[model samples]
Target chain A: MVPLLEFRNVAVDAAGSEPIEGVSFAIAAGENAVFFGVEGSGLKTVAPLVLGLEEPSGGDVLHRGGTIRGLDYLERLRYKNAIGYLHGDYGLISSLTVEQNISLRLEYYSEYLPEEITAITERLMAELRIIDKRTARPVQLTRSEIFRTAYARAVVHDPELLIIEFAFVDQSPLNIRSFMDVLKARGADPAKSVIFMTYEPQKFVDFADTFIMLYNGRIVFSGSRQDFFDSDNPYLVQYRSTSLRGPMAIS
Target chain B: MMDDERKTTPSGGSVAAYVGAPLLRVWRGTVDFAAYVVSIVLSFRSLRFIRLRSISATILTQTRFTGIDALPFVIVIAVLVGGVVIIQGMTNLPRFGIEGYFSNLMVIIIARELGPLVTALIVITRSGTAIATEIATQKWSREILALEIAGIDPRLYIVIPRIVAFSLSIFSLIIFFDTAAFLGGYLISLATLYMPVGAFFGNLSQAFSMKDLLATIVKSMMFGVLIPLISYYYGMMPRSKSEIPIYVSRAVSRTLFTIIVLNVLVSALLYFSWLE
Candidate 1:
């Protein structure tokens, strides 16, 4: 069976910086892949490529064995609708209230009645504990509220593939655990595939089935969780010890 | 290295380069804007697929902001202009032994020229800058990407509503401005010049032709389209937060320039039959 998502020798060029070169990976259905990279490691670029927001400068990004680079307008829309993306910057529309932002997709595309959309939105808002801030604009919300709101919007439709970038980096341990629990509950569906691009690998070690580490735009390691823990890769060693001295330069 | 480069560079080449670069950029910008307009036109086909409820809500909000909220200011400008035109015409036309054409002068100045132009100026100052800044902010915040992720086309949701609202709002505002100007002109003349209300209205009725009304409509519609298109084009060009203000300033300047040009073009076309 084809993997749910695949990156085939994908090389993305960044202006005035190192380019992500000769990268290859895949995630099968129901598998969880966590990507950990230092800041400026070009990990953030992967999300836009997968979301079709940016095309790869070389190679291809395949969604279920089909190239996603140049799908026509309707095909692109359909592809996007199947994936749930939580952007690193918390991409919430400032003009819209939290409730409006959450229900935007449903109100626009879903065949559900208005009452049903409201009900679903309410449930998600309540789950994320942002029900009280439903009527507030994004500018009025705290950073945590913004993250929760973005998270709720991303998962509101229960998409097949969920790609979350740089989420929960600054959240309390309790909040991260709670969000992980929510992710765990969602993962029980068996067909859900998740790719998390983050800076903190240790925080998600328990949740990830596969761990991929990048240094200076190249994958330093990719393996199962058990192998990841057992390996003596210098980057892994550096990460585990939280040491300042390592092969991977801090800057 | 700097001295070597400077030694190799010719003064004439530098002058040509300095002049050619901006001209090339302007040419490129014109081509890009033309392409953007074409894309907007093409995206209209997808309007049928978009939800009408969402479109209507956006249009309503835009109309309230652009048209309804502008009423008091528009009224003030109209009254002042109307009174001044009447006062000037009364003082001057009689010297030419053409005092009977006061109403014609009013129609020519207010309805044919100032109504649409003033309304457009107001809109460009008020709504055009707001739309550009809002879209630029949304882009800087990654909200446009968010819409794409959610499978909603920004063209349909953002651009179309603003286009429809600006057009409708400008059209209505021009009509309101003309009416208020005529009424204000008549009242000012009645109080100061002692002109009979019947004669004032009768002359105006004769002077106000269907062509004047057509001119106002045409100008408003054209201004409406130009403002939003220019604003959105600039708004979507910025790549960073610091660039938002620069892009917005460009949007305002471009919208103002385009509206004035379009107004003049429409007026000349109607009056001189230049296209014919």
Candidate 2:
């Protein structure tokens, strides 16, 4: 099957920083790929780029085989509807109530008046198990509640490709499964692709179909999860040495 | 020797990397601000419903921003200025033995120049800067982008309301300032100068003219539009993720500069158009 998204020779540079140079990666229609990198690495750039918030300095980001560029409002809206982004920090609004926040993505597609918004938000609130906090703002919610609310907002529209950053925990396998189950319940297609960026490999190792390693803004490895686990190449050795988990897990 | 060379090379590389990117970002920000303005105009036509919704919200929300919140400072400044003007007019008039000219001078200067200009200046410093900072922070947070992503144009939603609200606020403050200054002048005349009430009232009416009134309104309206536009332009211009904080200062400087230039132009126009 054709890839849902492709980042061809993706090169990004931010103000006061060197270019995150020459990175290439793709996510097929039904794959979940996670980028494992050390702290302060350039993986954060991928989250905003995928969401179309920042135009790449030197690269083509193809959505469904067409170069993502110069789309009119309706077409751009269509693309955004299919893609859900949770960019760690740039993902949620704090002043709006939980219901208002969750309904933000859905408000574009549907002509939701106050009543309609309230009804749909109430449903999502219940499903996410934060119903009592419907009127409460994001600042009032705990960190985990904020993440869950952000996740609820991302999936409330039922996006096909879900991109997450700084999520998943190495110490909580059951929690990871529970979270994936919640996503599945929310109509996130088991066949739809997911790209998560983080430092912890074991956190996402069970859920990810492919593992891509980024070092110094360069992709040093791209392969199946098993190949990543099984590789003893010098780059992989170096990654293992730096990782919190010194020994790679065999599935 | 190799170690020394390695440290120097990395340090130099870091410095070059840091300096090079921001200069390019400033160029990018200029281009981006232009594109945003153009896109705003285009999208204004395309998204009427969203614009209407935002406009209504802006009208309702800005009552506080423009009216009630701005009241106290507007009154205080106008009153203090009126007192200063009367005291000076009284002092200077006695020297010329034309003490009666004090009320005429007070009404003409306050209505023609001081009232509208002072009101606009206060609103620009207090509310205009706040509006710019608010919009800039919204840009930084991706709230503005969220509106765009949702097919809603931000200019109508964000900037137009501010323009309208600021216009209303400045106009109202000018009206209030004119009233306060008159009262202030009257109170001073009665308490200090022992000027008769009927004479003061007669002088105030004689000094008032249709041209002076029109000039004041036009200048105030121009200022209302100028403050918000300059603030929004500078606030929304910076795209660099790091330079977001600099937007506040840039907004202030740009607004102040634009307002001063506009004030000079309006004053020249008033002098040429009305006096001649």
TM-scores, all models, native as reference? 0.93, 0.76
Residue B97 CA error for candidate 1 (Å)?
1.6
Tens-digit lDDT string for candidate 2 (B1-276) = 698897767576788878988988878966876786676567666554452443555565675777678898888888888878877787788999987677667766787778877887787778777777777777787767656554445676667777777777777788899888888766865566666678777878887777777777787778777777767777786776667568767777766766777766776876675567
Worst 10 contiguous positions by lDDT, candidate 2 chain B: B46-55
Task: Give me the runs in candidate 1 sitting further than 4 Å from their true place.
Answer: A14-18, A175-178, B1-20, B273-276
Candidate 1 residue-wise lDDT, A103-191, digit = tens: 88887766778898889999988877889999999999977888889988998887889988887756676654456667777665579
Model 2 complex DockQ against the native: 0.14
What does each candidate score in C-alpha RMSD? Answer: 3.3, 7.9
Best by TM-score: 1
Model 2 stretches with alpha carbons more than 4 Å out: A9-25, A28-30, A39-42, A54-59, A104-110, A167-181, A184-192, A216-220, A224-251, B1-51, B54-59, B90-104, B132-157, B194-213, B233-250, B271-276
Give lDDT tens digits, candidate 1, residues B166-219.
889999999999888888877876677778778888988899888887887788
- Chain B of candidate 2 vs. true chain B, TM: 0.79
Q: Residue A217 deviation, candidate 1, in Å?
A: 2.2
In the predicted model 2, the residue pairs found to clash are: none
